[model samples]
Target: MAKVLMKGNEAIGEAAIRAGCLNYFAYPITPQSEVAEYLAKRMPEVNGVFLQGESEVAVGYMIFGAAACGERVMTTSSSPGISLMSEAISYISGARCPAVFVNIMRGGPGLGGILPSQGDYLQATKGGGHGDYKMLVMAPDGVQEAVEMTMLAFPLAEKYRNPVMILGDGLIGQMMEPVEFPNNLNKEPTNKDHWATNGMDTRKSKEKNIVKSLFLDPKVLNDHNLTLKSQYEKMKKQEIRFEAYNTDSDYQILIVSYGTMSRVCKTVIDNLKIQGIEVGMIRPKTLFPFPEKAVYDAACKKSCKKVVSIEMNMGQMLEDIERCVKGKKEVSWYGKCGGDVPTPEEIINHIKLLLK
Candidate 1:
């Protein structure tokens, strides 16, 4: 694997191709336009399809169409554009279509700004569209994870028959970092003629496989919900992933963060540690299949006192931290939104206040 300097957005597009995704469709959006441009050049070289849809809404439906054909497909866009595609995204979730949606988030409530912001943390984690469903959200800190996690996403999406979101902030999308490409994708997407609305084939399921999230009867909905709950439980066991830094050093303060903010938090950890202040970090890679057990274990440690829930949003995941370690540990939140970035020194100052 040879390392090459690449932006996170470009890495994701290339990784999708490397991961055997031949169908690409998306509308242009700031901070993520590189993804479309990258695929435009790369897909043609490989005889793959690259379509610039008329709108984000059209692109999402195109994803549905390709997934229905049992094809490995993907799309990329930023905040408000994603909002426009919510209806289709909900449809994709309901259909249980196996596809990848890359969201390089920008500031938003509505056309907020084009700077880095993990403002969509709640939206991505909670099935950004609608209905009672969840998306497998994979957050990447740098270009390497941007590619690796995307490669991981296709298989994971197929394994669970769920749509996966590669959630990144503008910093991750625009910042250049060294990344190593896979020599070969080495795997083909599983044949999904079973339920795929693709033409009836020998591998089709005996009954009409209706991909749906609707159950009219209360009992049916309950059973479906129970099944979904079971899936979440399994994800917690199989997919709860995070990185621990300086955690084993008996730190009294723990910084819980994800995406770009976590990188800033890391610098703060170094500053605090040098000043003889005990601080640690728990950076989550998968936000939905949260690392609740890790937080619980940290809370049980007498050395751990307070947990800081930091993100680029107005404390959405903060509620999640409270649920994970409430009563057992005091949880606090510090963040900015609409494209505002927090400096490492500021994070250190915040930690200093906590340590007081």
Candidate 2:
């Protein structure tokens, strides 16, 4: 199939359709409203459900209800809206329902600007809601990757029976690119016979499945938490994903980044190479099961002098990089938040100062 020119948000909606996701519930917000707009028009044609909830909070539960019945459901929102939905996210996590949510991040702390920013790193990767739960966070650097990852989220969610999050910024949500949907993304809706509460027809029917987060027994709750932890550990071993650029040969500096900021870092590296300054990069695709070992190995390269992290927020991923490198190399950061993105020239200047 020929690639089609598409905005990131619209492409994601189409990807969900191709992936056999038949139910979508969301509220409109800037930088990501196009996803809801696109799905609203397309879902009816495909006989899928596309509902615009009264609020993000309401949408979150709507996702949970549909997913509990074993539906391939999804929702999209920006920063403040995501914050509002965190409570339901926590419930979904505790209940172990399979759902996919996308966050086209904007500057935040409290209703920050609606421009591109990676300010939700901590919120998405770390525990955003009130519990000991983690999301499978995938960060895509471009529109095409966003489409691919959004398509992948459904299968991954079903495979693990957990919520998966696609983490991108306003830039990715708004940018246009040529993308081709996969030919084999047509998956049947998952069977919920074992765990879904779709109702029983006869006495021979199996026991009704109960979906809830409440556990009055301390020991049972502890066991549940441990079970979730085991799933996370398994994902860390089996699902860690990243891409290395200009890393084959030795380089003077190692740059760590993700999402749209990583694209800018690539330009900086290419321009610096023209000037005879060698640099390399590691772009992480999965944020929760972070490619920690990859970052450590790249930073430990013999010719690599120092490690630098460039982000659109105030150094959120820096902590993860530091944890990965384990102080073997000095780690530094450069960032611009509140709707402003650093230019390639600005990033190169930071690299020069670090080299000095």
Give the top-scoring candidate (TM-score): 2
For model 2, the superposed segments whose C-alpha errors exceed 4 Å read 201-205
What are the clashing pairs of model 1?
Answer: none
User: Which regions of candidate 1 deviate over 4 angstroms?
Assistant: 202-204, 212-222
Note each model's CA RMSD in angstroms: 1.7, 1.5
lDDT of each: 0.85, 0.92
lDDT of 1 by residue, 239-305 (tens): 9788988889889888888888888888888887888998878888999898888877776678988
Quality of model 1 by C-alpha lDDT = 0.85
Q: Write the per-residue lDDT of candidate 2 for residues 1-356, one digit (tens) a residue.
A: 79999999999999999999999999999989999999999999999999999999999999999988878899999999999999999999999888999999998889888899999999999968999999999999999999999999997887777899999999999999999988976576554564466778722347777899999999999999998899899899999999999998679999999999999999999999999999999999999999999999999999999999888989999999999999999999989997888999999889999999
Model 1 Cα shift for residue 170 (angstroms): 0.5
Work out candidate 1's RMSD over C-alphas. 1.7
Worst 10 residues of 2 by lDDT: 195-204
